[model samples]
Target: MRQYLSADKEKELIETANTLMAKGKGLLAADESTASMLKRFQSIGIENNEENRRLYRQLLLTGSKDLANYISGVIFFHETFYQCDNNGKPFREILKDNGIIPGIKVDKGLVPLAGTNGENTTQGLDNLSERCAQYYRDGARFAKWRMCSSMSSTSYNFICCSNLSERCAQYYRDGARFAKWRCALKIGDGLPSELCIRETSNVLARYASICQQVLRKFSFFSGFRTD
Candidate 1:
């Protein structure tokens, strides 16, 4: 049986989800880690210093108030959550003022799953409830956690996905109104065999269903790489 949340809470979550999915609206996922941002900057020949990162994100969040026309929400990394634009206003405030919802990425990251050949699982469950409460108080109406399932020899499994779905229920009860899971797929000649496709799809579906059962909105972000 699925757990229950108070009607008020459920209503709030549903509203947030609907706003996020408003007609012709989408989300901006600026929750990249420092290392990932560094790599991205390197690709553009820009320095990856803190000031550069702040300026770049500031440009995105405050470049124009017209962003809310198409962007309903923005997922921010921890660092970006506290960052400010040139006017000393918090990024969250800027987004809120533009009618955009502010969200936070709460996962610690992926760690290798023991007894699996390089399989990975997301961490940061410890103190998650506390973190969610604080984030909510800090102007985040929703939170994101990335749980990934990958395809590899001896690494494909549904158990990890199942575990993440179970945890999503807990997170919702703890005040997270939304969640995200990523399934990484690699495309190549003779790769992503039938087994890979079926298993990964099943896992993603299960994750979504479980989140719905708990009244939390779910987002699926799939990574496709061709090599």
Candidate 2:
């Protein structure tokens, strides 16, 4: 037995979801790590310089009025947060003036997934909730956390999923009423079976219930989990 969102509140949240999403818009994710950004630059034949990064983002931020129609938000690195357009306004301010939310990548980095070669977990649990509060105060409306889990012969997906969802629910309780958990499966070689589907749904439902309880304590809002 699981708790669910009421219909009236559900309709209200649906109407209030990201304004950008109302007109076929999506978010542009630019919050790659330094190492990841450098790798991305290597592919594009651009040097990973502060000026280059600033110019790149400034270009995107100041590109066109039409850009704002489709691109709802720009996720920035710490360096980008401090950068400004040629007119001297902070990029964060630039985005907000155009109905776009400015976001920050708060996770420190990734760490090795113990016993799983070449797989890893994000490394930012230290004081993360406090950091998120500060970012929210700085004008970030949403946040993203990427976590990886696997279903293998020995791995228990329920425990892993439950733990990850619990952490993300706390993230929302801090300040980001609108946040997303990017849960990726890394080593699932098994095919989806009836038991697997049922178990996965059960685990996810429990996770949503816990999330709703935590959120209810934090804010007087209501909605159902969509994913």
Q: lDDT winner among the candidates?
A: 1
Best by TM-score: 1
Clashes of 2: 0
TM-score quality measure for candidate 1: 0.72
- Residue-by-residue lDDT tens digits, candidate 1, 1-227: 44445567656655766777689988799989999998999999999999999999999888886899999878899889989988899999888888888878877887766544445656676566566667766777656666564544543433434433223321232224566555455434444456545654654444444444443433222221111
Compose the digit string of candidate 2's lDDT tens values, residues 108-175. Answer: 66565554434455666556656666666666655555554444645444433433422333223222
lDDT of 2 at 90: 88
**Cα-based TM-score, every candidate:** 0.72, 0.65
Candidate models: Cα lDDT each:
0.64, 0.56
Worst 10 residues of 2 by lDDT: 215-224
Off by over 4 Å in 1: 1-3, 153-176, 183-227
Model 1 steric clash pairs: none
